[model samples]
Target: MAAEQTSSVVLVAVDDTVLAQLVQAATTDALADEVTPPLTAGRAWTADRVAWLREFHRVRRAGLAGPTGEATWAVVVDELIVGSVRLKHTDEHGVLDMGIWLTRGARGRGVGRTATAAALRQAASLGASGVRADTTVTNTGAMAVLRRLGFHLTLSDDGQDVRALLLLDPEGTAACEVTSEPS
Candidate 1:
């Protein structure tokens, strides 16, 4: 599938300085409620700039290594940082794990959908046959988006978290429409 584009959203290479700021913004009380539980470690790092910078370098180093590493991008809208998406190859061949999060202001818009679709397309380019994602059961917004993106529930052990998977077509299409606005 070709890259998807939105008038308001774009996926750009993650900038350590900007990412650090975005992470700090996410920890604010106003935005804290919008952050997913799985991202708690990231929020915590905001309190320690040194640690966050170190992690940033580590992530960058890993990305430079190979497919076994991760590919992360910043979700930008109107030239402002709004969120992030990451795709990491798993132990299983032709399969990757995806993670995404948007700021409070960006939620309920089409930013997440567009950014996620772009990440999935990137995964396909990397030879991934499928992508998996995990989200807390209570994050109904994310779950709904995953469903809309053709991801089917694969596991929901304990009811606290759920895992979903989307299998790419042989032709590499994700088989989902990239609408301009969120449903």
Candidate 2:
């Protein structure tokens, strides 16, 4: 499935064809600092790190039905892979965890907001009552995007992390219509 928030930004499900592009995009535009755990939070992208990145997506490709209960998508712009977005089923019933990251060039634009909006709609479609996202206090960009997307933000007591939550409508209505693209 593909969710387009604008003509410039699209979220395509992670498949073998898209997976390679996703890794390439990461190596070229993203820092290890911005990705999730298991990746060293530093500037360098070593061969081992790249290999791990490739395997990470491969293992989770099953998406909602996968053992990890997570669905990831490659964020494409003007037909080029630029970033990624994901939604994961959480232990809390009817809630999903959301994540997103963009290439350095894509940051500061509305791309993150658009991709996140699409992810929220996907969560709602999957019967989620809310979506949660967590980021570091230093990640002002992510904090701003989550807030603009209508998520309630709470700072960690240690002032190191920020948690954001957006409750969907009770009926699970999509925030906007995402045009479907054929697989």
Highest lDDT: give the candidate number. Answer: 2
Q: What is the C-alpha lDDT of each candidate?
A: 0.71, 0.80
Report the CA-based lDDT of candidate 2 relative to the real structure: 0.80
TM-score of each: 0.77, 0.87
Worst 10 residues of 2 by lDDT: 174-183
lDDT string for model 1 (31-78, tens) is 443444434454343445445433643465356245447777777788
- For candidate 1, the lDDT comes to 0.71
lDDT by residue for model 2 (13-130), tens: 7888898888888888888656545566466887778887777778778888789898888888779888888899889888899988889988776777778888887788788999
Residue runs of model 2 more than 4 Å from their true location after superposition: 1-7, 36-42, 174-183
Worst 10 residues of 1 by lDDT: 29-38
